[model samples]
Target: MNDRRIPGPLRRRPAAASLAAVALVALAATACSGKAEEEGGGGGGADGVATDIGVSDSTITLGALTDMTGPYATLGASVTQAQQLWADQTNDAGGICGRDVELVVRDHGYDAEQAVSAYSETSSQVLAYSQFIGSAYVNTVRERIDGQDQVLVLPQAWSADLLGSEYIQMVGSTYDLETINAIDFLAEEFGLGEGDTLGHVYFEGAYGENALAGSRHAAEELGLSVAEQRIAPTDEDMTAQVRALAGDGVDAIVVSAGPRQAASVAGVAAAAGLEVPIIGNNSAFAPQLLDTGAGPALLANYYVASPALPIGAEEGTPAELSAAYAEAYPDDQLDNGVAAGYSAISLLGQALEAACEAEDLTREGVAQAMLAMTEADNGFGIAHDFSDPAAPSSTESYILRPDADTPGGLTVLGDPFTSPLTDSYTRE
Candidate 1:
C-alpha cells in the first residue's frame, strides 16, 4: 500500500482525531440556530416534525465515513470531492428543503475499528451518514446502526447481508446480480457455449462470496463450468492463481476484487501467456491500472461490469454530470468513485427532499422515504427502484471495455444489460 496520503484539496482529517473539534463547532452553530428558531420551533409539515439531532431550521448535517489513507484512498478522495460537489450544488440551489446540507467527512482508513470509533463520535451529530465506504466496516457497525436507528447510504452493493436492512440503502446492483449480468454478456457477446469453463478470482469476503454465488448460479443455468480462486484484499500477487486457472484451460476469468488485484491478475496472466478474456466487477476496475505494467494486458483482454455508465461516456447522464464536475473541479480525475459519490448524494437528496415534503426529517423518516422511492433517476443513464425491499436496488449493469482515450480508461460496450437470475436471486 502507498504510504503517502491523497494529495491536494482532497485530503480529509482523520475521523478519530477531528471528531471532537468538528462536533463542538457544529454544536455551537446549532446552539445559535436553536436560539433563533425557538419561536418557530420544529420545521416540518403539519403531521411531520423535525426533532432530529442534526436537523435545524437552517441546516442538516450529514456524516461521511470514508477511507482516505487505506487501500481505497484514491477512490475515497474522489468520492469525498464528488460528495462535496453535491452539497455545494444543493446549497447553491437553496439547499434541501431550506436547510443547508453540511457534510462532515472522516477518514476511517478502511479499518472496522476506526470506522466504529468514527461512527460513535459522529453518529449523534448528524441526521444520517451520507456515505459508508466499506462492506466490512458496515458489517461491523450494522448492529449499532439498527440499534440506534441510524440511516446510511452504503458505498458498496456486494453484501447480501445489507438486503432489506432498514438503516442501510444501496445505490447499485448487488455483486451477485452484477456477476450474473456479466455472465450473460459474455455468453451472448463472446459466443460462450455449453461446457465452456470460466475462472473466478475474488477476495475472501462477503463481496467476493456474493459475486461467486452469482457466477455459480449463472454457470449452472448456462451450462458453463466454474473454477474458483480466493484471494485476500491485501494479497499482492495473483500469479499462482492465474497460472492455475490458465492451466485448467478456463476460457475466461471473472474477478471480484480491487484495482490492484485486478492489475495483478491481468499482468500475471499476460506474462504467463494466458490471453483469455478477463471480466471484473465494478470495483475491480480502476483508471489507475492503466498506469501500471498491466495496462496493455488490461486493454487487450479486460472488461468490467458497471452499475452506471463509464465516467466520460459520450452520451448519458454520467457524461453530463462528469462535464459539470470537471468544470467545478478541474484538478480531480473523473472515475467511477466520483460518479458513485454523486449517485449516493443524489439518492440521499431525493430521500431528504421526500422527507422534508412529508414534514418528517427524522432518520426513520428518511429511511421510509428512501424505501418509498419508486424510481430514482441516477443522473448517470441508470435507473434504480427501491420500492421493492426484496429486489436488488439495481438489476442491470453496463459492460465497459478498456479505452485509452477515455478519462476512466474505459468505455461502455453496449446498453445496460439484465439477466433473469437477478430477478429470481433471493436476498439473504
Candidate 2:
C-alpha cells in the first residue's frame, strides 16, 4: 500500500499491544447509543492523543447509516458486513493508536424519514460515518453532517451535488464523471456521433439526475441529441421507457437506475427489437441479474461504467477481498458492494492512523489528515487524490460487460479511461 502518512505532527506513541490492552481494560459500555459505547472523553488518556466526541480513552466509534429491506437491501447488507469485516481485521491488528475501532450501524430501509431519524439518533455518538448510503437521503442530512456535527462521512452513493464538502468525502468518481466516461466508451465502440440520439433512463433523484447531467454534457460535446426518460426508483418495469426510446430511433441507451431497472430495460429493448448498445452506471447492475430471463439480453449488448474494479476480478485488491469475504461470509455471495464498503472503511482507517500519528484524534484533526492525502490508493484500481474537495477523487472509470461465467458476473472489457470532455465540464 502507498504510504498514506502525509507528514503530519508526530510524536512517540505507546506500543499497539500495550494500547490495545489498556483500551480493553478501560472500555466501558454506553446505554443510549445502539453501537456507540464511548461518549467522548476530554483530555488525554495514558497516551497523550487528543480526543473528542465518539472517542473514549480506549475506543473510537464510527457510524454506518445504510439501507436494508429497501431498494438496495442486498447491497446494503453486503456493504455493512464488509465494514464489519474491516473492523474485525483492524481490531485484530491491535487497533489504531491503541484504540479499538467500533462501528455503529443502522438500517434506514432507504426511506427519507427513516434515514434522517437514524442519523439524528446516532450523530452524537460517532466520530464519523463510515458508510452513508443513498444520494438523495444523504443530501437531506448534508447540513447537519458538515455544519452541525462537523463529521467526516464516506457515503456509498456518489452524486456531484455532494462534492465540495470538507466533511463529506467521496471515495471514487461521481455519477456525472462516470457517465461521461460511459458515453465516451459507447461512442468509441459504436460510431455514435453527430445527429445521433442517446436515450437516458434514470431515476428521479440526485443519483439519476447527476448521471443525466453527464449524458447531456456528452451529448453536447459529441453533437448528439438526448432522449430523456425519467422514472421513479419504485418503477422497475422498463417496457414503456424502452419502447419510447426505440420509437425515437435512439442509437444507444443509458440506464442509471437499479439492477432490476437495468435488466428490464435490456430485456424490453431486445424484445422490442431496439438492437442498441446499452450502457449503465456502476450501481445499475448486480451479479444476480444473470440468472434471470433478461440475462442473455444484458450479456449480449449491455456495458457498465464503474469507478472501481468489480469484486469478481482476479487481481489486485478485488482478488484478496473476494477470498477473504468468501471465507468470512460463507453463505453470502460476492458483489461490488463488498469491495466498495471495504475501500471506504480502509480509507477512513488511513485517516485515523494519520490523525493518531499527528497526536490529534479529534474530528477536526482527522478531517485535516484526510485532506492531506493528495494521492490515496487502496489497491482499488484507482489512485484517488482527495486534495480537491470540489473535484472527484478520480475521473477514470472501468468499462465492464456482464458474463455468466465470471467470478463476480462481470469482466473488464478494456483498460480504464477518462473522457476528454470531462475536463471542460463543470460540476455544480
Candidate 3:
C-alpha cells in the first residue's frame, strides 16, 4: 500500500505514456540519513563495522524514489510496500541497532527526469537510498550519482551492467543468469539438449537484445542452437510471429517481452497449436503481461524465468512483512513482482542488520558486510550466499509451469540453471 502521507518537500508528476514496462534486478547500498542519525551515538561493532540499521538520535530515515504510479505501477507498489514493511518491522524490533526506522517514499512515475528530481530532492535526507528503478532510468542516474559514496540499494536487476559497475553492486541474479537458467531447465528436464534450436521472441529494444545476448552466451556454453525473432511493442497480435517460428525448425520458445506482448505470443502460439513449450522472462509476470485474468487460455502451456521466489511457495519471514502493506495492497492476484520485491527486501534487511552492528555504517562498512556474507538464510533459500555483486548471480532460476500441469502452476523443475559466480561470459 502507498503511504499517503509523503513529505511535503517531495513533488509528484504525471508521466508521459511509455512502453518497456518489465521486471528488474536488485541491491547495492550505503548512507546515513537524518543528519541526526549520522551524528548519533554509535553502537557496539563486534566485527569493526556498523550495521545498515543503527540507532539515530531521533530516527533512522530511509530515503526512496520509485515509479509507483505509472506504466510500472504494479511492481512499484509492491516494492514500496515491501520496503516500508522492512522499516516497520525494524522499528518494531526496537529499531536497527536502536534507532527508530523512518521510511520516506517518492514517486517518479517511471520518468527519468522526474526520477532524478526525486533523487535530488531526497538526497542526503536519509541513512540510505533504496528504490525500484528500470534499466534506462538506472543508466540515467548511475553516471550522475557515480561520485556519491552513499549506498543505494537497487530494487531492480540489470544483469552485469550494474553489477560490474564500480559504483553499484546488485543483490540478485542477473538477466544473463536468468535466461540461461531458463534454457537449462528446458534442456535437461525435457531432454532438449545439444543440437536443439531454442526459438526466441523479444521486444525490439535494449531489454530484448540484452536477454538475447545472454541466451546466445548460454546456448553456446551448452552446445545448443537458437533461432530468433523480434516483435514490436506496439503490436498486440503475435499470430504471425508464432506461425513464423513454428514454421521454422525452432524447438523451445523463449520470450523476452513484457505483459501485453508476451500474452499475445502465448495466445497466438496456443491458437496455432504450436505445442513447443514457451518460456519467458520475469517481465511476463507484469500486471497487464500475463493473461491470468483470461482464464485457462492465458494460463496454459507456458513457463517463466523467475528472478525471485514463487508466490505459491511457503511464507517465511518475508511473508509477514510490513503489516500495513500486506493488508493494504491488492496484488495477491499478481504476486510475482510482490514476491520479488519482498525477497529483495529480505536480502537487504539481513545485510542492513549486519551493517548496523558494524563499527562503521558508512559505504565501506555496508559493502563489506554485504560482500563478506556467503550464507544469507533469506526465507526460501532462493538466494543463499549471494555476497558478490560483481559476479552478478549467486543463484539460478526455477520453472513455474503454472499453466502446464497444475491450475495455479507447479514447479515442475527446480533450479534448472545455476549461474556461475565467476567473471567470464561464455562463447560457443
Q: Candidate 2 — which pairs collide?
A: none
How does each model score on TM-score?
0.86, 0.90, 0.76
Ten-residue region with minimum lDDT total, candidate 3: 7-16
Candidate 1 off by > 4 Å: 1-49, 423-428
Query: Which should have the higher lDDT, number 1 or number 3?
Result: 1
Query: 210-314, model 3: which lDDT tens digit per residue?
Result: 678778877787777878888765566777777888888777888887656667777777777776777888766553334453235456667777755555554
lDDT of 1 by residue, 373-402 (tens): 877886677777776554557767888998
Please tell me which predicted candidate would have the highest TM-score against the true structure.
2
TM-score: the better of candidates 1 and 2: 2
**Whole-model Cα lDDT per candidate?**
0.76, 0.82, 0.58
Better of 1 and 2 by lDDT: 2
Candidate 2, residue 288: Cα displacement in angstroms equals: 0.8
Q: Candidate 3 at 229: error in angstroms?
A: 3.2
Q: Which model scores highest in lDDT? A: 2
